[model samples]
Target chain A: MSDHAVSRRAFLRAGGAVLTGTLASTSGVLALIAPSTSWALELEALDAHQGATVLQFTRHVFPHDRLDDAVYALVVKDLDAGAAEDPTTRRMLIDAVRRLDEASGGEWLSRSAAEQFVQVQAMEATPFFVKVHSTAVVSLYDNDMAFAHFGYPGRKGDPGYIHRGFNDLHWLPDPPDGASGPVPETA
Target chain B: MDMYDNRTTFAADDDGVVVVIGSGAGGGTLANELAQKGVDVVLLEAGGLHTTDEFIADEWPSFSQLAWTDTRTTMGDWRVARDFPNLPAWICKAVGGTTVHWAGASLRIEPHEFRARSTYGDLAGATLRDWPLSADDLASYYDTAEKKLNVTRTNGLPGLPANNNFKVMHAGATRLGYETCHTGRMAINSVNKDGRNHCMQRGFCFQGCRYAAKWSTLYTEIPAALQTGRVELRTRVHVARIDHDDNDRVTGVVYFDADGRERRQAARVAAVAGNSIETPRLLLNSESSRFPNGLANGSDQVGRNYMRHTTGTVWGVFDKPVEMYKGTTMAGIVQDEARHDPKRGFVGGYEMETISLGLPFMAAFFNPGGWGRGFTEAMEQYRHMAGMWLVGEDMPQADNRVTLSSEARDAFGLPVANVHYTDHANDVAMREHAYTRGAAIYEAAGATRTYRTPPYPSTHNLGTCRMSERAADGVCNGHGQSHELANLFISDGSQFTTSAAENPTLTIVTLAIRQADYIAERMRARAI
Candidate 1:
């Protein structure tokens, strides 16, 4: 099949992804046997029954819209994937999220959106919060590098002046209030 | 006790000179260009001479130094970027601004980026407009900038060998009807220029280039500005206010040195060169009865129209080791979506980029979930991780603005910049459109996993002091001259009319050079 044909099919499948529906349809046996999540220690980072981690963990079980779950999970997966392991990194990650959950007093998933935002901002003040945020952005950047690896489009173009009407903007309205301060047009 | 308390005033009997605030790319270049012509200058910068040694391999310390240390920073509902506690909006207050730690992906505005507003009309709740300057007007300046900053990355040899990734993007482009366009043009030196060597493909350009291959103000303009001996750089000096007379012309500036004691210097003219975000923050923070609503803010537009191009990225896994982390942070780009697409539902386009990956520790914390042994399996796949992002145009919104929060104060006792913004439906729609396009490319590249993210904060913030033909219509005029103050000018992104899809460093540099000519001519006429 053509490349377009394949991704379109995958995208269509990736969409219409109802989490509850998938959970209901898939048996726990199937969930346990998923490719990316076969390891027990990987699932034990957080108190699995707790607040946001539980929601976040389940969200990761079946990748959907919440990019962080997949991103964070994959980061841990990759760090340990290599032969040279860094245990401190793992401890920091688990501790960071747990502290974040606890500092908010376990009201993560149940908190109002506004409160969640407030707590998230406060957490960001900590190095752990900054670490997660930066890691997520960095992961996304890595993702882009991979696209470039295979040759992608859209990363081309100049830094500024992306306007189509760049030439026709000649209809420069006279200065507001008719105060023609120094425009010094460059011909 | 707060830091910078040892700041002391230095009064020179010589009172004739122009003062440029925030000596990064914009201020640094303008200062050099003007100083080369024998104009005395005082450049104020908040961050100090942080040598490369101060830089660690970690992202936190590096980011705090490279990114905006401003605590009031926040990212509002920018999808995946919302994960950032603060605004993913990163800009440095250092000598070179963000260029001190940029991926070195400097590209010029395509002929289209300068006039999105005229082509697309008023986008929903956003205020997009035509810049007073044209791409043709900036063409010469871009070349001059290229020569000075060594913007010569692609010298024939294809950047990023045609991997499965490019194959996909190319196929997607051909399928999506963007065949006329190809890869992006960058400021990276593919070949040596003017005594600088080509990029070593070190992939750590953002941490401050040592070989001088990367063009940062610290490497180029500041050295030149200092060479002229007409420019005085005050590192770690935090400018507090632009003092103005009854006539509203900036007469001098007050600042605190790194040690934090008060000091002031007189000036013949003042150019605020801090980039879009903090430039306006400084102006709005400076309040006086003579310029009641803040210096040069007669129309109350000092910090209005804050913007960031709605960035979208498509990520997936490939089967091979692309080794994308080996070269300059950004060596390739996609320009197919570089223009406004009326049919695409927004007046903006996006620039797709091939970004580099992080080191082991950095990547470890960032790789997507699965742990211990499973995580190790993913590490083996680290060489396969691939992605691309399209920086689509975002409109200038009056209500989506930056204001000094009365309650929020920074370490300097200055009010913090409170960004009030919500992604306009148009920007969000464009983000979706760009992501869909990116995802198509990823799938074409034979991606086993694919997803789209609406970016929250990545540098490239502009339009807080948007330019317009009218004074009341914008905080500054087409020349970036403060509408209310005759002797005040801005050489930063704050004066942009619309946030272009491309990274803004080159544009900021071009405008600074252009402003130098304008200010010089004006000063020559007045014999200042």
Candidate 2:
């Protein structure tokens, strides 16, 4: 069990106010909102409980401390859309939450974060978990929020990094001068 | 540049024109060189044309925009077949083919690599054969190719400045007592020349260079060929089969246009350059009564001896940040390992090139189906990581091949190519040694951790329709002409007799240039 899972569980225990829209305000609706971020999503096929479990499962799979719940929400948003269109996918996710609840002695969301981690780990190789894990791997890291958090400055603006310190490494000792050697002639 | 002649279309019965089936490093350059010799050519590309401006900076989107996402299958015990079962080779289908996605490391094949069978001797289960021509035969052509591509470290062009990734590799290689490390000979321009802009170090070499700094046939050869007014470039045209006459000589090609309408274009000469897999697939699908097995497959060697270089990735994590993706995707090299020595437990050698993957690609490919804290912790240190790619000659096995799949049929109702491969013993030893050396380099450079990643989908595909001097030994002759059919030619890496330790683009282009001269001379003598 990671610290992130514990903190996320602590936020959810406080009357679930962290997820405000359609989660805290409305009842019996499938929706979620990131704790500190302004990102929110509504599921068309999955229930509120199923959607929340998918979010929790994605975070447990990738579990980065610096990333907000919003990054994991991106995975939930995609999985929810997939569930909305495909009945097979919807059933798979619904069955996934049911199994998780059973594994956690019924009502997975109310279980301790450590127990939830064990439950997710036990089902990591299942088709339902594989779908969520694979989708989360791409959706979590490819976006802007993950880029900023991971310190990957993807694609500099305008003319690229030609003049913007492409070779600025001050930590290591520099190599001997002309270490690249001379140019070969075509003739 | 108004490079495409959209208003022009060759007639179905135009037998005087040479039809090139694929627009890529081989076909594109061959078409332009042939047109320069007053020959008419029809360059057919399976994918649509994407100009430089349309190229995106992102990874997944660029892959979708350029990759050859055809319905193909893979078999055998290779890692690619297990990791990426559907995608065996990472070549492109667009106008420029894989050249659009290449990292621009243009290296010439070493002299000894051309005579692999003779120098390395016969090893068990390895179907090694010496090339029909030596490096001396290709030296002039290589010179021409280097100048045409405006490759750095040649023609007095300066090498690219050492980026952070290169600095890490240089320091590590120097510490390891490897003296042949450098910024490498890359096709990406270090200065503005040849009407193309210099490299901006944009770090997306595999996703189509947006500034035209890296040489791609999409902007260089195809456009130049179209400007000759003797060439017709067609896009979104999928070639299905090569048609032959009663004499067993190739006469035309059958293809499906963008609208899925079947069209036939007659040709005096038909050159196949659809990379290794499809080149053999097209020939096998064109089986006729005169040539029952396949066109030019007299020895039944149309799709055997498949080789994708023994490759793997190594990433070193350090306390200090090494922003790898801040410059060219592949910017440096250590050439000392690229020499044959049987004492090293491998018949051939490998090169260690500096490589960088953006965050999206890294997550997707670092370890497919990898997760947990062990995986995320390494990825979390993305800013502090430096990467290198190990590419070496993998011995060709007769059973490792690309055959027609009976299960998977493409959109054009043609059976797709099923690529089957298994790593040979030499390949396994070479990769293991390279991994140990790569890890040692990182450890010498004060690394905290190192990850030896399995090879990604093959970007260095070679040897399916191979060349040979004897007709009974292989498919094509020294000039890439079909041993049985004088009018048929193979103008791609498919004609490689043996896989070399160097990159194949420069060699493929060199062969295409030499083939063009042979084709022109034969046409003048009324040979075909």
TM-score to native of every candidate shown: 0.71, 0.94
Off by over 4 Å in 1: A1-187, B1-13, B52-58, B79-82, B153-183, B359-381
In order, what DockQ does each candidate have? 0.03, 0.33
For candidate 1, lDDT tens digit of each residue in A76-182? 33332221133455456556566656866874666665565555556545654444444443443244322332232112211111121111111112212111111
How large is the i-RMS for each model, in angstroms? Answer: 17.3, 4.1
Candidate 1 global lDDT: 0.61
Error of 1 at B440 (Å): 1.1
**Interface quality of candidate 1 as DockQ:** 0.03
Q: Each model's fnat?
A: 0.01, 0.54
